[model samples]
Target: MAEDRRKEIVRHLSEDDLDRLLAETDDDKISKRLTFVKRLYKGATLEDAADDVGRSSGTATRWARRWNEGGLGLLTPNFGGGRPPKLDEDEQDELIERLRDGQPWKSQEVQHLLSEKFDAEYHPHYLGTFLRDLGLSYAKPRPKRPHQPENPDEILEERVDDALDEDDQPHNKRAGDDGEGWVVDEDVCTDGGTVIGFFDASQPQPYDNSRRVWYVDDPHVERPLVKTEDSAVGFYAPNGESLVTFTEDETKERICEVLELIREQNPGKRILLVLDKHGSHIYEYTRKRAHQLGIDLIFLPSGSPHLNPIEKVWDYLKWTMCPIIVENEGEFKILVKDVFERITRRISYAQSWCEKFLDLQKLS
Candidate 1:
């Protein structure tokens, strides 16, 4: 009876059935089973067929036995037991649509939202894969401001004179035991400058930065919609000391106020301030006031924020604090101040900026 059943099974699958099975099945194991059975019906020995398809002879024999008992019905997947999906198809479709409503969502925020809305729980790493499967991707969000400077190269070239020698090595400075009386490149400051710092201002926005966000790319993408707060001027000193204050405007008055703060902090000390050429910075009154306060304002060439090591501090601050998502100006100021304090408390950060110039050998 078993011999007759095996013969019947062999006759049941035609060449067309074999081709269709191989073409339609995507599962690797199922495709291997079909190939094994088809080869057996094509005058191949059980061992030969198993060897051709890289299957064990025992696996081939077991599958053949099942086929003889139930024909093709036994070959179909059983489709049983595993963890169910956290979201149904409809819910998944809705979640994708909700994400499209605008603004990128952080991975943690999205994970929390999933738990609240659909009672779904996922490991943070797995959540990234799940998001990609749903046709979402990670992207960096940048601020879209008008008339960004295009002369960073020129600015860098200008500063290179102050940093490099004729042979392009660092222009080193000699210092006393107290690390004072060092001259960098020349004309950097008087014989004994008190403090060295980078000065700049930035207007942070409500928009997020320095974090991965879930976003769908459209061919015709526009800048992200974001709200900005009032600007702040800052002076970052070599010892990681920073003077940051909120300003309603970037006028000469505000510039003078910040300089006064710098003067108060370094009482009776000369400051070598590396800054850019904003109209307020170049204003006759601002320059005179800076000179009177014993602050030598060294202007950076056009469009050169990269030369300012303190710019890195601004980048770090935005990435660390902006993603927290403050609603009002009050919260924004408080959070920014707190984060700034935490960052500047480390003296190592200040030394790192100062080392860039100090490491160079003195120009002979």
Candidate 2:
């Protein structure tokens, strides 16, 4: 009933009063509103009334409310626009430039800078939205150590290509080719089919384990704090055949042994091993052993671990094993080997590396 009464002819003003105001009004603004009230009194809706006066329904409602509350005086004009921005447009652009000066900024620090420079203040919660509005995002920056061989991809690709290439003609066995007269097809460049292997060694300490856990009432996920580390030297292939050796320590002798082991496993295929320039693998004896075994070695550029897919394999292995419980270093080593075997069962790990750096169609 009250809504019906208010809708009839607007409130407080009667039909006669509106006619009187419309006749005597000299103000264009007040006269426009008087015409709107007359439309409502003659059966037009709030929407139709707004359309008659070239105003929105919401604006008509505000005008009607103001007219009911304090008559004409209250609806004249709202001079107070809104809370002014702490910083003007030019000042905002300057603040954005200052924020992007390559230095990470904290909320409190930004607040201080604003107060110090522009004499402006913002609450910390609102500042996040302000920074985002200014085209900035929050993130933790990681430190990246610089490395050598500026063109690492080109350098590495060239080496791997050389290793995988099969020479058109065979050359005589070199005088010092391990004193065993190198297998002509077995040399770094060979006519035999090439078997590419990405190799890396990871030392997961006894204290290494998953940092996060889903638990009820707090489960104490723990690992033994031991002084010794376990070394895992791994060779992964795209065809899903992988080899991982667990050792107390990685040494040149162990590397040569692993090479012999791989040769024994792979038989007559021309082996091309892609590995980092580690001391053990690059030692003269190790190179001689590789040549003797007819396995070609391609070294990745220094400090460029991202180029090798084997590092991801190691990370996956550690992550897979990190959740399980193990008591001592002996137990940890066993668990590590078991987890590695399971992870290597799937060949998906090497697919990305091969697609980026290898021509699998040229294996023969």
User: Would you list the C-alpha lDDT of every candidate in the order shown?
Assistant: 0.66, 0.70
Q: Top model by lDDT, which number? A: 2
Which 10-residue span in candidate 1 carries the lowest summed lDDT?
Answer: 168-177
Off by over 4 Å in 1: 1-193, 209-228, 347-353, 356-364
Clashing pairs in 2: none
Ten-residue stretch with the least lDDT total in model 2: 168-177
Q: Residue-wise lDDT of candidate 1 within 1-364, one digit each (tens)?
A: 1221222245568878888989997877678778878877877766677778775544455566667766677754453457667885457766776777754899888988788888888898799888875657799976533443566545544454354323322122212222333223232332343566788899766566445666677433255544545787878876425678888889998899998888777664456677888999877667766765656666676655667776777888887775576667787777777776676655334464344444334311
- How do the residues 1-364 of candidate 2 rate in per-residue lDDT, one tens digit apiece? 2133235443566789889988997877778877876787787777777778777544566566656667656655533467777885457767876877846887888988999999988877788887765656789976564766678889887777766665742221234444543443343343446678888888865445447667889677444454345577788766525777776677999888888777766766677888888899877677767776877788889888888888887887766665566667677777766777677676467677777788777765
Q: Which ranges of candidate 2 are over 4 A from the true structure? A: 1-80, 112-119, 148-151, 166-192, 205-210, 214-228, 327-331
Q: What RMSD value applies to candidate 2?
A: 15.0
* Candidate 1 lDDT score at position 74: 76
Q: In lDDT terms, how accurate is model 1?
A: 0.66
